[model samples]
Target: MDTRRILRRTRTGACLLAAVALLTSGCSFGSTTRPVGSAAAAAEEVPALTPLPRSTPAALEPYYEQKPAWRDCGAPGFQCATLKAPLDYAEPSAGDVRLAVARKKATGPGKRLGSLLVNPGGPGGSAIGYLQAYAGVGYPAGVRARYDMVAVDPRGVARSEPVECLDGPAMDAYTRTDVTPDDAGEIDTLVAAYKKFAEGCGADAPKLLRHVSTVEAARDMDIVRAALGDWKLHYVGASYGTFLGATYAGLFPHRAGRLVLDGAVDPSLPARRLNLEQTAGFDTAFTAFAKDCVRQSDCPLGGRGTTPAQVGERLKAFFAGLDTRPVPTGDADGRNLTESLATMGVIAALYDESAWQQLREALTAAMREKDGAGLLVLADGYYERGAGADFSNLMFANAAVNCLDLPPAFDSPDEVRRALPDFRKASPVFGEGLAWASLNCAYWPVRATGEAQRIEAKGAAPIVVVGTTRDPATPYRWAEALAGQLSSARLLTYEGDGHTAYGRGSDCIDSAINAYLLDGTPPTDGKRCS
Candidate 1:
């Protein structure tokens, strides 16, 4: 989904630090000449360009007696390890950063397809946690049987050399900052909050604050691929991970193997465009939820006469109410449903369909029972908050990476104000606020190191780009754009909703992806799945 929103609630540096404590945490060109004929040929086709050299495989030393620090991880048949790589690839001799890695061996009678890496959207989402908790044990057996499922926490993320910021009290204060400011005093408070958060990050992790861009992480992936003894990389990445994977292909095209980029990000777009598109996406998802909610008896928004527009109005009213007077959730810390938390709760429900019912129930409880515990749980889960008020490093790293990848969309309050109307037009439900919130990076302590650029990995093998028709985070057109940009790419469309396609529910999507991972066969171009 929207990387910014996901990062804000779940991995936003300050919010993440507050939550748990605490508890925490390509191508060779083949030349084919079309025959010049009167009716068939509109124009003479040019000869296919020659493909570039493949990335030379690095030598990997096999471990004879590898003993991982295994624990009673919640998932069965999984093991964890700490993998080390240089903090800066440009300086390989520099001190290394420890990455949390997890794996589950292939359960196969058939020949193995080596290691298959998986990342679930958020630049801040814990890859190890996702692997141990879901993909490692929960992925479809057909795919799991042929590859050793693997994941590595990116630099500055959970279990890695995590970036830290605010402590419990500080985080609570930061999350309560008004995101949609209508007055100068409120705007000042928001800007101060961002500045303080950025200052906290710089003070806590200066070195990391400068090095967490998607490009550096992509380089880290290459190092991991070498360490794993894989000749080429096989991976499935969603949301921001799609940007990471695409960056990898661009950097080391020849090293690419079977790749599935679901919920694709358009590498060609700048941060502002991405943010604007995402605001629209969330609005679309809310509209869908609103339509479905009206048909149900338990909808929080009034029923019958209430249209999606009315539901939007009601939610906005709730947000406004929370802004003026927060709702208590009975937490020991006296935490209440502030505007930030409430918005996050809505964003969290956009990830999966199963969570829609949860959203309905939670909204009902908040409106009718005056109890927000259900919504709080969903928000906590999204943030990966722990028992204590401590948090993992996901959000810190997510910001570090995102802020570095592109320039801030807005540099000042005036800029945000000027852009508010367009953002609001994009998505009345979340647009204006998110557009303003996009200014979080403007006050960052570190200077951005990269900019949005097209990735045309010349020698990479065929890559599959999957998009959900009405995805709330990564817009569907991004997938189409990425596929068209890649020299050897094919587009796979999921005519459905929610973020990402494979393994969420559609057998058609899963089977197609499984086939690609098993053999070296990319799905047919323009393939569609429901």
Candidate 2:
């Protein structure tokens, strides 16, 4: 999936509210909802929180007292395990955090190239889920035979001691927050809702919250590498995983083997730039969808005479309408299609081309049918709100990591108001609202612990950076930026659409990545594929 879409989807309104509830309840939710104090002031006042020292393999023995039951790879011959690590790395004596690990052994018709770890973005998406459902069974046979395919759910994510919040009814209410606030009162309501949600997360999962940062998760990957007996890490990271992998390369350059970062993120940008660029990206994808829809008989935004711009305007107007009146979804709670849910549905469609049809059906249902069931499904999928209205910790952890990675772009409501014009210029449909939404982390309780820094990883082996020309999430420029930044980076370009280029479709992209993993032959610098 496009890293931006994945991030935006996971950090949607409901998720943000949950994260806020998780982080800010004790600080007087009503009184202290301002941006974090200045870093200098914070540093002088609040001691820097240190991470615990790394534990050796021997240290992990006690935690691994019980062996996991190995199940069928579901792809003929793969094995899975539950690896345990300390929840509070600073205190190894504390309780354990379990990660679901999966591996498809090398077929071995060729020489073994060692393990190749793969992460399919989301920061919330399950790596094991992706492997079992797709990569493990569907990856090219040559590559599969030469390298052991491996995956691990990051800490605080699915199957990894997930951070849980909200019962069914509460979540139903949370998902319907109005994103396009019509007035000051509406905006206050939205902000209050976010505060409540974040407070909930703080209450529900305190220990897990502090340790879910990208840096911490990157550290966790090193532990997984040691347990797997790998001398160095050879990996493929998609979407947000690219950030995780890049952080690893930065922290342990010498340990980085052959790494491939696809659908790259410009780790150097702050949250505002990230959200603004992403808002533009959604516009690009929506424009593509609009054009295609106009050409089809079932086009919901009217026919050829109506331009994509007009379609976007219509959608925006629909969102504005929802601010006043939400469309009913027929669920028991009277679940309605609010502006936040509608925006999430649009963001979800940008991940894969196959979802465009679903988007069309959803838009049709919302605009004409006036039934929100279709849009609700799209929103639910984005939140990973499954059968019981239960949510995955993906959204929770996504915020925890993102909030710690950088300070919020906007320090106050005034800043967001000033940036709206530029944001809308970037993407008329999604700009203003998303630009406002991007201010969320500014209100996070914990001060940001990291800043944007360039990654050179000088001693690491050649690493591949892949970019798709028309990728909606992580834009093509970010790939170029990342490739240029890494000392040994090789740029692999996929001249296509969608999020990450490899495995989703293009053989040219997949083969180049496979060769790098199996034979340690990085693709020629500036290799372009279609």
Candidate 3:
């Protein structure tokens, strides 16, 4: 529901962990109007960064000088280690949080280029998992031959001191809880679910919850950078990871080096506006899917010549039917394909066009055959639901980090009610449900510690910002905005679909990014690749 779900998967062929992304929560800001400049043009007025001193603070020098005790883990070539950082950075003597890090040494015949740290977004995504599963072995051979691929699971993420919330059954029930309420009673039910989830997280990790903010995570990255023996940071961050990378650059501009932010998030927008725009972005992606679906003979929504609007109406009607008579998914847990789960299924596939065919088949089965298993599978995959009734710490950490990063998108149901019209205008099909979903953070136990602000990272070396034309999770304008905001950023446009561009099928996008990582050369500003 924090809809920052970006780069949940590896490549097109691999199963992606659904990145729950960021959704902030807590106290309200009354009478505060949505920030203007929702457009890219307005975001171009870059802010000047006030960076931290080049010299490490005396109290934090130890953390920056700690050595990683790497041992073989995961795949054959990969190694894992734990890096320690203070629980409360401002009070280093208070306590410490150990972070999990992984890396694969460069397999080179050429001179090694230090390390290349990578993160696959999800304030909650497992960076170590991503490194072993994808980046460690899937990167360009030349790049892989030259740089040690690295990753760190930020505090409160997997392998790190993770934030624990609901158990498997509890999470299943929470996911099934109706997001689109038709009556007051249902709305209260949804509200109660959110409260219960937040409470569970608070009850589970009271202290860690308060310390998992993005700012803290960025600080953790810097410690890792220093421990790796690198003089500067070379990184690749996608989706919410982009925000992390930018924050790093802003905080340590002098140490920033060859950063690639693909599928960027705009750090300038408030939660409400981000939710609204993301709702619109889903519409944009669905429209593309609908247009393609109508051409396929197996399409369940509609046939050729049918407008995307009509396709949406049909899908909406189907959802309405499921609101009452939920279809059977034959899930081992006996969960049915409720409207909420069904919607997540559709949303998951939209992240990658390669999944569109699977979505169509799932929709056809759910709509025509009255079988909900396929859609259920998609939803399960999105949530990273294991066959054994287990779940990763992803959702819990997602909420923990998100709630600490910004103010709640909506403080109350009444606020959501008031904003429904604008949300619906953004996407007729996803508007109602997503608007309700955005309310999850209102009950967050931790009050937000950060706010929307531009990151200029001035004095940093060239940072490449890449955006897909129709990126459903983080929009292209966000890349444009981020590029415009960062003093040394180069905007590389991928005229394609899906979430992030690099390491996908585009030789152009891949080559450009590969070159940047290998040679410290960035693509020209505003360079376009199909």
Best by lDDT: 3
Alpha-carbon error at 306 in model 2, in Å?
3.1
lDDT of 3 by residue, 377-405 (tens): 87877776788569888777887887787
TM-score leader? 3
Q: What is the number of residue pairs that collide in model 3?
A: 3
Query: All predictions: root-mean-square deviation over Cα?
Result: 7.4, 8.1, 5.4
Better of 1 and 3 by lDDT: 3
Cα error, residue 209 of model 3, in Å, equals 0.6
Could you tally the backbone clashes for each prediction? Answer: 20, 17, 3
177 in model 3: Cα distance from truth in Å? Answer: 0.7
What TM-score, to 2 decimals, does candidate 3 have?
Answer: 0.93
lDDT of 1 by residue, 126-176 (tens): 787778767787777867898999898888887788888787677667766
All models: lDDT?
0.72, 0.71, 0.82
Models sorted by lDDT, best on top? 3, 1, 2
User: Which of candidates 1 and 3 reaches a greater TM-score?
Assistant: 3
Task: Return the lDDT, model 1, position 105.
Answer: 86
Q: Residue 308 error for model 2, in Å? A: 2.3
